[model samples]
Target: MSNKKEQLFDIGLFKRLFQFIKPYNLVFSGVFGSVILIAILGVSTPYLLQQAIDTNLTNRVSEGFLFFILLMVGLLFAEFVFQLLFIYYSGWLGQSVVKDIRVKLFNHLLRFKMKYYDNSSVGVLITRSVTDMERIADIFGQGLFMIFRDFLTMIVVSIVMVIMSWKLSLIVFAMLPVVLYATKVFQKYMKTAFEEVRNEVSNLNSFVQERITGMKILQLFAREDVENENFKTINGRHKKGWLKTIWYNSIFFPIPDFCASAVTGLVVWYGGLASVVDGTATQGVLFAFVMFIPKLFRPLRQIADKFNALQMGMVAANRVFKVIDTTSQIDDTGKHIAKNFKGDINFENVFFNYVEDEAVLKGISFNVKAGETVAIVGATGAGKSTIINLLNRFYEIKSGVISIDNFDIKEVTLHSLRSQIAVVLQDVFLFADTILNNITLNNPEITEAQVEQAARDIGVHDFISSLPNGYHYNVKERGVMLSSGQRQLISFLRAYVTNPSILVLDEATSSVDSYSEQLIQNATDKITKGRTSIVIAHRLATIKKADKIIVMDAGNIMEQGTHEELLQIKNGYYKNLYEVQFLKEEVA
Candidate 1:
């Protein structure tokens, strides 16, 4: 019962949905005009046929026969015109609404906090923004408006059937109870089926997207047969969900069809009896009711199908609206606009976690003066990356004061805050585009020559220029065509071109070959000079020349000093980590 209540037309939900239609009032007017004309013509067809037979054919008069034929022809042509207008307008309206919704949903997603993405599935988001959006459009195309036309036609036909002959009308409507009962049962089951199908689609999509993205891992580990079996399980569930809906459809449709036939036969028998015995029914009235039977039950059966679409649309809309209504956003309430930064940064008593009660960073404190270089060395999951994410305001801290140049970071606009910092990550990501476009990120203000100069400044100019198309060379999706080292080299150019006030190198040379690592090392030294720099490093070579070194373990600052200063401490965390990790690298 609760599920059924949810599928009922929530006035507020539809009111919001219909707001998309309000923009195209002219098309809406055309659809409404078409529906009314179609209804009038629907009843007129049967009445005209009965009139022609009773009046013109019964009198055996040729005089009025041609007029009836011409009138019928006129009615059909008008029906065609209205139907063409109806299809054109309704289809146009549906497409237009979905297009707007798709854009709005995408833009909304862009503002969400990184924390939201940390917990969300890319495939589920894709389903909501793409697949579900298409379903919502059908509410206008084949769901709501079509059902309205059906109901309107049914109501008009019902009135006329009664006015012509109540006895015949009563006989025809006797099947309504049985048909309505079947439809109620079908709708109850179909709604659950469609909901399950939608869930399965999201699961299937997420599975495929994750597997495809990790294809390298999949093949390297030789997990093909295992993944294929898992895929079959997911795909089987998707098929079963759709089949459940089909099973109900198979049972439900025949009920209406059988009821229509039964009602027609019963109407004819009663009409024949009335005409012969009571003299209250005419042959014309009986013939009109027979014609009206199909018109009536046809819409009834079609309404059942449209209800299925409406159920799906409503389910999709609820999901979409729920996402849009989520308040997980990095508040950009500060009005301050920043053109550049002096690069002084401070973090005091910062605490953060990706999950509740599972702290990833705890009471971390650090400071970097303008144009100073600070290197952070720690094992993976030591909170090195969390500091970088916090500096850019990617996630909100539980309790902290993070400031740049004496201004609270939270009191600054996100664009202004992020624009000043540039990072080159260990696992570099490049879009499928020309090197120059990926570097500039389509910013029209950064000319190609500026990028070239930045590339030369970082000592990677020769490598980029040697590429097939130099700066114009397309990297393809995620820079798959390039070696891992080459992708990181490109990322160096990307970070350097911006000439950021603060520079971050997140284990930048960790995975590179000797040649690319040397090039990246040179790029780092060239870019980090006279800038506020934070280096998260595994290689001793990356941290040897830092003005200050902060060693972290389990989110706490364990030691702070220069290269030689920290090594002399007895039983220090940095000393143990260096002996265990970096000492071997230097020897190699």
Candidate 2:
């Protein structure tokens, strides 16, 4: 969504981009050397042709003719060699810079806090990483270095033309001011058009990504026609954005072609007349001037086109830098390594809110001893999941403290802290990978034997063995190949294999079949044994055997005790919720 229009030649942006190329100094130096050699050699061809015509061809001398012909051929071959080297090195430099940039950008995204992602569009991020990065690479591969070579060629040609005849050079120079003015206008208009193009591209990407992700919802509601109509509108805007650039190109590119032709005609007409009138211009000089004029104006024309790549690259860099400059990272100032936490968790009057001025957990406090199983039952939006988020430090607490084993959670390294805990949620996510890889998550230290043993211990080994490939079975994207209950069982095994010191089950068994529920209950018993476990479930029946039960209503703890002790409270929140919610679920 960054709409900042960067200048055509932004020094700051280029400086940052060049840092990525610092490691490839040798390759870039080779490119620079090739450009210079090509420029010097490119001018030699026309000059050598002029010499051949004036000295050898006109006099009908065979010796000089053969020598000049061989000399021109050698110069042409050298120029070809350098041109090839320039192309190869420039492409190598561009690709190398892009590779480093992509790695850095991805790493930056990985460190961003969860809140940053909550407020960002995934499609826009993808555009910046993939499409925009390509634009930046084009600036180097096809724009900057080539522009340098072309401009250098023009400069060399100009100096030689002036030396040959100052009067003819003046005529060519007269057309320049007009061409330069037109180029300025073209760059101005094209920059604006390219910026709009990039913006529309991001918009189109965002729309398509959302539609694809939510296709099931659209189908379920039978809104395909409506969605398609909306897509057409976005797709149309994207088309218009690109068409605008083409319009400017059609107008601007022709002006330079016209100038090149006019200069060539003027040189031929005026120089030809001068030769007949006073013998001031030679036939060889006129011929060389005609050729050199186009060479000089050609780069000027191409620069106008190359400016598109330059401007687009700067705009893309601006957006990319914005992401890299974002300051939304979780504070990991804690030096505690948590090598041996005792699993005791304490929330001392902790407060939190996902949105400003709307408290989700208002002065909530709780405690769970090591090796205790605590069940938290609450209605929807009663902050059941918020507690789990807070314990894992996914979101920083607004006030008060959350600690494990008397060590403040914030005063510990995130890796060390989260390494000791695992959470299994109701809506489990599985990657498109083999069952063994999904369970072990490709951890080299966690062997196949270890995963199989953990699966066996968790009582899901028989269920997995029933599959086509057993542990090696491929679970397609989001585990769409498996049932919801089967996905939950996979998640349970994944969590259990890690051997987390503290376990969290956030409504893990609330949406499973009766048969899968039995399997999950059995696995839950094994995983939660001798660990501090926090179970968040709406089903009251599942928490009957928990060491302690905490009933929450509207962000406040209504009751906390054993199941029987809480039931003894007359007309308590837990008693009513248990009667109304659990009874209906049982009857169903």
Worst 10 residues of 1 by lDDT: 1-10
Candidate with best lDDT: 1
lDDT tens per residue, model 1, 271-353: 88988899788777888889999999988899999999988988888789888888888989877777889899899999999
lDDT of 2 at 447: 91
TM-scores, all candidates, are 0.95, 0.97
For 1-588, candidate 2 gives per-residue lDDT tens digits of 343343456787788899998899999999999999998998887888888887877677666788878988999999989898888889888888988888989999987878888999999999999999999888888888988998899899989999999999999999999989989988888888888999999999999998898899999999999999999999999999999999989988888889889988998999999988998888788888987988899899888888788788888888898998898878889998987678999989988888999998889888999999999998888999889888888889999999999999999999889888989987788999998888888989899888889988988999999999899999998898998889989999889988899999975665679999888888888899999999996565668868998888778888898888987889988888777877677677
Task: Give each model's whole-structure lDDT.
Answer: 0.88, 0.87
Cα distance off (Å), candidate 1, residue 154: 0.6
- How does residue 10 of candidate 1 score in lDDT? 61
